[model samples]
Target: MTLIDDRAPASVARTIAGISNGELSGSTCAPELTEGPWAFDLGMPGYGPGASQGDLLPAGSAAQGELPERYRRASGEELSSWIASAKASLGSRVAVMGHFYQRDEVVQYADFVGDSFQLARAARELPDAEAIVFCGVHFMAETADILTGPSQAVILPNLAAGCSMADMADIDSVEECWAELEARFGTSPDESGRVPVTPVTYMNSSAALKAFCGEHGGIVCTSSNASTVLEWAFERGQRVLFFPDQHLGRNTAKAMGVPLSTMPLWNPAKAGGGLSGEALDASRVILWNGFCSVHKRFTVSQISAARAAHPGVRVIVHPECPMEVVDAADSAGSTDYIVKAIAAAPAGSVFAIGTEINLVQRLAADYPQHEIFCLDSVVCPCSTMYRIHPAYLAWVLEELVAGRVVNQISVPSRVAAGARVALERMLAARPDTTMAA
Candidate 1:
């Protein structure tokens, strides 16, 4: 493994993506992002300039390329002290946001921890906040940046964290697909003649993809609001072309009573429209070729194995899984919906779940008496989401207190305005009672 260039942010970004994907693996002990000590935590007060945002190693910070003595300890008291001091040194503007699947240690400091949409929503709500220390992956922090104001800086604690699912849909491929689609669908605007096509992408995509959607009357979506987003597309186009995660599109449309016959698969490598009538004409949603690697690991064999070993078991999965897997399962929904469903399930009932390892383990730990285990009995997490560590959180916040900033993520006025229009359409379609997206 190559030593990460602490100098080039771009190089660091690539290292992060590679490390998370298991393409570059090594053992390094230094806690690159850990902040400061607790006694010094209460040293500074709210918004008082002291340390710069990019100053990961403030003057009083521990020696470079080494873990702080405080962080190396086992006690929560020690951990708390380090976090508190880091918070103090960073100033009052620091806010740590954790995803539901974050490790317990990282989750310990999250001011707000939730699903991706929830985190983005929180970042948007705190427009005036000086720094958003995201305890998730690069894509998530990027999403937060798009939602927040320009002045407010967004950050990922660990530079190594990145999402594989998000990576599957690059801007170049989407652009290429769009060029081909226009030839097949007719470039004339929707029925109202306002736009040629209403492009809707899953929130898991890059900002560039979102920009593509925005530029072409497109919007973004999470697992929760996919249905509404698709319906919004229907109003503007003859058909909906969804991407990256084929299972999500298939499962969501199926739930809306979109017949399987009406839905067709779109193989990116295949030539021309990659589809035709009966399959295309009968279709309500056209799915992309991408899929979630982690979700794909969960299989029907695992589900059956669990059922036979533990009778009266309930199996639930995310929409990212294959249709055959979903078909054999008891139910399916987004992370938020999954949480609610499991919480509502009767106590003592065993559940075999198919999703990220961190979430399933966290759920199992959260709910005792009720036996809960992952559909796949393996130790795995979304490699990208695991990137942000507590040290990074402290570093970003410290920079804010010092009146300097790093990784400022903000959608431009033009892109944001267009994106907002697409987003509003999806939001409006979803009734007030449902907040899954």
Candidate 2:
């Protein structure tokens, strides 16, 4: 693997295309990734293009229309110039936030770049900006909208940039699960004032899910604060029902000493989550059957390969990975945690990261002093994040400069109110800790 010198002039799209055309020397999980993201927008309704391409999108989910030809046909240089012009025109009226998982091309334009938790804080802090352009995914934009003031518009560059994991737990399915839980374990509080069940939704979920948590006396959690939020839930409820990502819930709860046998998987597609009454009675954490397709790709074999190749190499993974993979790694944490760990390591240290490819590749470029590479060598980015191509960004910014709000993501007032309560609870649960890009 080669270190990223400055930003790789070759964009991810270009690299994948080069590999597909047999003009470049590298590996990619899929050749279909070579196609332009707009191509997917015009065709099937899967996650635009990348890692989660095979994952299913829920019915009635919004689909992006064909991008304007002017933006679509423009070269990278042209798009960059247009984006610059729009940003210069908008000035302080706009604040662009990027997720760590975004490609270098899109991330370069962000005023503030960090993990979803950090970006959520950025959204709330940027009260002066008239608009917050989220260069991440649909859920992140919905989160920014929920966090930002009503006057500040939160715009998603591409309407199809949605998380597959987040889509797995739709409003109807979750509502059904909640009803079953309430029936199985009555809504009454225990003698210690703890309720029978407390709903905890990961930040990756839709605003509707966050609101559902708030309305149900539950809370929202991020990868950075899953343990803290889970602890809060335990204080208020006898057993917690965590949704959207089972690995995160199980890993965080297990780290807190919750036994694996007590954490039962709740399959939304099955009756009563396919669990017997005795199993439900002894449950400590009811995990949802949903996972990040990107993280799920990592494995213990990859960690072993990294160690075998580079003796003393550090293996760090995200909590979203399967529990066995997390257990096999040297350490596990959030994206911010992985970045910080690498930053603090001694010079010349070799590190293997298990997460999305974009952040890992960028980190390799940013810190040439150390050796950093993704555990999975086959280049596969978060499919949803990959959907936000630079063209879409330029289009959105140009639209903003033209006094038009394009792809604005707004949570309904009722849903926002509920989501806000849960998000605020998450904020309060955060530890007194500092994070860096």
Residues 87-153 of candidate 2: C-alpha lDDT, one tens digit per residue: 9999999999999998888888999999989998989998899999999999999989998898999
- Cα-based lDDT for every prediction: 0.64, 0.88
Alpha-carbon runs more than 4 Å astray in model 2: 1-7, 432-437
CA error at residue 413 for candidate 2, angstroms: 0.5
TM-score of each: 0.77, 0.96
Model 1 clash tally, residue pairs: 10
lDDT of 1 by residue, 286-369 (tens): 778777766887789998998899988989888788888888888877787778878988888888888876677668767886
User: What's the lDDT for residue 382 in model 1?
Assistant: 52
Which 10 consecutive positions of candidate 1 have the poorest summed lDDT?
A: 46-55
RMSD per prediction, one decimal? 10.7, 2.9
By TM-score, how accurate is candidate 1? 0.77
- Model 2 clashing residue pairs (backbone): none
